[model samples]
Target chain A: MKKLLIALLVSTFSFSAMADGHAEWWKKAGAPYAGTVIQGVAENTPPGQFAGEVLAKDFEKLTGIKVQLENTSWDQMYDKAIKDMEANSGIYDFVYIEQDIVYSYLDRDFLVNITQSLKDQPELVAPMVNMDDFTTFIDYFKDGSGDVFGMPMEAFVKVYLYRKDLFGAADAKSGFQKKYGYPLAPATSFAQWRDNAEFFTGYCAEKGMECWGTTVQGHTGHPASTYEFLESIGPSFGLYNWGVTDDFHSCVEGGGSLNGARAKAALTFWTSMLEFAPPESLQSTWSEVASTFAAGRAAQGWVYGENAAWIASNEEKSVVVGNVGVMQPPTAPGVMTQAAAGEGYIGYFDGGAYGIPHSSKNKEATLLWLQYIAQSEVQADWAVAGARITHYSTYDDPKVAAMDQIADGYFTLMQNTGYLYAGAPMYPFHAAGRAAIDPFTYAALAGEMSPSDALDGACEALDKVMKDLGYQN
Target chain B: MNSSKTAWLLLSPTIVILIIVGLLPFLYVLYVGFFNWMPLGKNKEMEFINFGYNYRELVFDKFFIDSVWRSIRFAIVTLALELTLGFLLALSLLSSFPLKAFFRSVHTLPLVIAPIVVGAIFKLFLVQGLGPIPFLAKELFGFKLNYMSSEAQAFWTIVVMDVWHWTPFVTLTLLAGLSALPQDPYESAKIDGANNFQIFIYITIPMLVPVLIVVIFIRMMDSLKIVDEVWMLTAGGPGYSTRFTGIHIWKEVFEKRTYGYGSAMSVLYLYITIVICWILYSVMVSRGKANEDE
Candidate 1:
């Protein structure tokens, strides 16, 4: 009996050790690391952008590993990161990611999913690994499947910024309701959103305030980044019912098809909404738009409440700093409010992720670095600096909670606004659609092509791209 | 015979560069185009059904045809406008002015600005409500010009923006050609008692024709691939009104992650550009030949 017990104990110990198929990358890359620099990709890094600065500082200090952080704008970075990995350029060690294209990368092993670490590592939890931190990450991070992608980085939910001075003035409020024949409040659906925009534009114009009713990105800008624009209204147009077919293959699944009427209607509404935008808005980017609204020219607009962090930080840059009103994307009639802000709406996955090129001799170092940043503590540090940190716990931390700015408004937006960025295996024609849509969008803004024509052209162009990409029909 | 090896050696570096940077990537594009290639597809060894499906879509896809049409129209219209304005400016510059150098340099200002920066600058001036230009339209003209809002306006803004950025390209080329003109013909015409109009028609214009044709050809090639200004300025919106072929293919390779298909589209677009270029070249050569015969 004694001999049997000894033998069993020995076998169990041996089996457990074997389960660790790879080295403890942290031990090899961080404090205990005895390797090369870890590579990381930082998309959405503007000059002096908060996330990039802190990441360069924190990742270095905490893990004691050098993170080769490549800072670039979101769209260009997305293109390069995908192209780099596709061409196998192992330039990144860690990456800034939105949920948008995460799935496709996960589905393809284009990235290393860290679910195993999540299940095994505890320090990665509490502040770092709070799965429920952001609503979309929780709902959309679908299981080990979500975990399999690089750890969630930042999440931004759509929030409304309105001219408090213009709308809140007692006379303007009552007068607006009387003129529009509706309560003067945040819009609920497509119709009200348009009415509100028109009212503001007309009022602002008459008042000679250089103000306009609403602002949305028709040009590819920040709103387009992380696919905030796609989920912003595309789903409200009935995308929830539209999805890829079962077996994760071709054909429509749940959401409406791209070629269908629902999408076309949404595209039309999108076009019509542009009528109120400022003239140069056709060329405006997200930062410029944010700056425009902050400068007190725009009366209403869809902005990520996290934007206030940028605004408040640069008071001299924004005239309306002390008076920016925050709200959520208006709901459209016949469209479920829930659909307008799905909890699982995620960012573009291609927004960022870390990968080892077949050329790298530093895979172990990269792995260790990934494990370190994936920790809750680092994520919390990120949130404090005003980035859309992926972890809920840090965002909801007592210190963060104490600060009413993000905890109350920005935090809530991240939590309850429902939309998460991740979806699909990366729409094959999304970028193509964006490119084709620019001129068509310009045309729509110009009232040259009706919204339907624009959508049809865009959709057709996208379909052609898809076909070019290898889609059968 | 003795110099054969030396000549081959002399050309080797360029040949190497052409293979590595130019011809190779293009050939690779054709090779990749045949496969249903995703940026993420190769490792998966995901077999794509291939039979010129991409080309088929390019020909038959309504979106593609529309984009091609829009892109073509945009290029043609923009070129005509830019050329007309550019030639006029060149003509004006040749006549002599107090600040000719300064004006010529200022015209190149838009060219020096990065396209993204130009996009930003124009965004301020062209967006609907706040722009000085729109304000002028509303106040001075009593017309609400939502140039950035309407599709027609938005599409034209791109044309205008391109004109701003590249009219100099045409102007500068013409100016250089004009400056290099032989003064003898115009002097002879003037001595023959020719009026300004007659002198311009017989002497000045004919001399500038070859250069104008060259300028047009160069602009055609450049316009076909004009991505940055259009991309940064409109991103191809208020709803896809001003999108171009370059924008289309770029989206395919980068945004869609459909590397194989994007490459195929690019290859086809490239082929079109090459064919168009070839035709232009042949026509120009034939025209030159006819001129020589005359």
Candidate 2:
């Protein structure tokens, strides 16, 4: 009787202490801004959805701050946030800053320096929020002084997704070997990719199956086509930063290779794949391509990593759920070496971060909300929910590791080879550059101009845009 | 207070609101049009450009000019088709028929739907592999019909969509006009042994000219400023074939963030539209007067 009473008392005290320890940091950090409300805006992507629906609720429960996150379409999110910021309306406390646009945000001085803010307000800093917990992707959100401006919520690389069921079929293996003198496999080079595209298209046709070789995200009227060519396809052919040199020029005369022979070849290769792609390729964007792959319409293609998790595991939305395979994007010879050496990248690493706007009125409260989300404890579930990772620890989390198996090692591949991928170059003129080159890219895809002529025209247009923007004399 | 003072007091709020919302923005845009001002980045500093600079850039911008021409073409084509179709529809509904009220109500359904929703409906109906139209085309006709596969097809698809959505508005307006037509002229024509075709060509068309002018003016203005449906459909693609002036200006102002240049373009576009409407009004007035003299 005496021992039982003593054990109960000891366990009770330990439980209370653990509970107190868990609540202590939040209570102290959140006491000042307990009832404050902060608003944020983000695109309605999977990651954004997770942050808005799950993480926001969790943060609010821990801290007394009310977080209202507006998840909207990609275009509308940018449009609303930019309009608000431009007008200094202070409508959004924090906004989603895409990796591609962070440079522009930094140049405009539109975001608060979170590192500096935490340093300045040491009282508000949470013990769990350490900068080293985040992956090197945090560097992408930093300004020139290496002070973090945005808190990365999601980071992913574009990858080559192939249908393992199709590639591993016995008949396909035998026929590909007979025809190409090699075993059927995921492509390792552009020529092999073309061969695979050709073989699978014919093979599917012969079997009377409603399948295609690949999905070409070549919407002639949308920006997706430009992204596929310039960011994904162009980089594989050794064309980086839209072939623009450090001097902000894209033409050969100005020492840029935008219209160089390799760029022309890259365009030709991409345009040629249209023949083997579904007829809807001309109208397809990134979303459509993912649907096409999920429907088992394409054998292989470059797919965004955001969709990889669901496409590989969700049987309801995906027909080839367990059959999806991922690999590094095929690159030209020596291009891989260059990317590995940090000289360039093979494909796009796309993601976004949440940044408190300079115009935000509730900066201190919003800062606490951000740090709450940034805690290492919240990341594993977020990564599983969104197929994104911003911390090294997320890869080791048992949930993520289990998901990695179901996703055919997508998470593992991202962790192992993510350095080979790069985000958009740091250009404050990102939109201007894309707008200038979009017309030519569209024309080339529509077969209105030859690949060479299209690149030549695009180079000239980019040069003119740079000049108009006062970047050059 | 006297009657005038009371009226002024009542009207002051509306006038003040108008100045604050409408007049002030217009004046601000006009002022901004002559400067090289960017709202963000290092270019946020406002630099005063010569007035001719923006106008010159506008003149030389082939894409903007092409988009303007496309808008003009779209306006003319949709107006012609809508006027003809709506007039025919109104004429058909003139006499009493079975379920006449039901037919009229059902015909006006498209008009009440928002333009963006209409675009989405059409997009769902025509999208390849998923849409029923392509499926039916392949299954029934033994050939695929992908509307977005070609530039001509996409352009015409937009035209057809606009005509389908707005023709009901025209028909309803004309139906009201036709209902209110003086019966004395028709009776006189019948007594004079006029045929149906003759009656329609002479009395019907002549008397309906006023309503037709109203319809034309309204649709012409609306179609010139068309953006939402087209944007939802193509986003001005297939090599800028459907990039109308509204979209062009929107891209400049919003997407590219060239505020001053977009302002210049908008001002010029507004001025041109006013001039065109004025000329059209003058021509119609003269024509009406000439008919009166005759």
lDDT measured at residue B259 in model 2 versus the true structure, 0 to 100: 84
lDDT of 2 by residue, A302-322 (tens): 999988998998798899988
Best candidate (score: TM-score): 2
TM-scores for all candidates: the values are: 0.78, 0.95
TM-score of 2: 0.95
Expressed as tens digits, the lDDT of each residue in B98-160 for candidate 1 is 998899888889888888788878877766555687788788999776644556776787888
User: How do the residues A194-307 of candidate 1 rate in per-residue lDDT, one tens digit apiece?
Assistant: 887888888877777877777766543222522333555565565431223322222223222543566567667766766786654554556667777877877777665445
Model 1: per-residue Cα lDDT at residue A145:
39
Q: Per-residue lDDT for B1-294 in model 2, tens only? A: 999999999999999999999999999888889999765324678789987789889999988889888988999999999999999999999988999999999999999999999988988898876789888989999876666556787799899999999999999999999999999999999999999999987888778879888998999899989999988888887778788999889988887778888999999888877777788778877777676666
Candidate 2 displacement at residue A266 in angstroms = 1.5
Instruction: For candidate 1, give the DockQ.
Output: 0.34
Best lDDT among the predictions, by candidate number: 2
Query: Would you give me the overall lDDT of model 2?
Result: 0.88
